[model samples]
Target: MSDASARPKKEKERGKGAGAPRVTARRPTLGHKWLRYLQEVRHELSRTQWPSREEWIRATQVVFGLLIAVGIYIFVLDSALSFVIKGVLGFGR
Candidate 1:
């Protein structure tokens, strides 16, 4: 059975000698909703602490440095494995 607390007030009050509550709030239109969403995004972006050019460049360089290191390690590992496999299988190139 569904919990009574999970139901809306109008639904819960059904057959309970209570009237449905009148809604006083109006829903915003689609255009106004989009405008409000964009305004919120702009406000949040303004509040965000952005990284400086030097920090971004240093971070990018570190990422590239690690990328190159990983690539070199993988290449060396693959070469070593290939050499061992070829020797074991008596296959040469």
Candidate 2:
């Protein structure tokens, strides 16, 4: 009874009939599509702002530092947990 319910019936009556077939999209050939995609990728890469060698080296160092820190934290935590588990189960013998 509301406008929302009545709008669909009106739209359906105005649109394609119930028996009309649906239209499908046609894709480009593989070779042409690949060439176009590569060109677009090159264009996008050219527009990108790349980091300098110094900046890249600094970023890599930071990443490695964090990785080592996390590795050490996990190693310590695992060792503690293993010790506790062995003590609780009396398996240290």
Candidate that would win on TM-score: 2
Q: Give the TM-score of each candidate.
A: 0.59, 0.67
> Across residues 1-93, which tens digit of lDDT does each residue of candidate 2 receive?
988886766435878777777788878899989999999999999999999999999999999999999999999999999999999998877
lDDT of 2: 0.91
**Range of the 10 consecutive residues with the lowest summed lDDT in candidate 1:** 11-20
Instruction: Give candidate 2's TM-score.
Output: 0.67
lDDT of 1 by residue, 1-93 (tens): 579786667654566545667669888999999999999999999999999999999999999999999999999999999999999997885
Error of 2 at 44 (Å): 0.2
For model 2, what is the alpha-carbon lDDT of residue 4? Answer: 82
Model 1, runs deviating above 4 Å: 1-35
The 10 consecutive residues of candidate 2 with the worst lDDT sum are 5-14
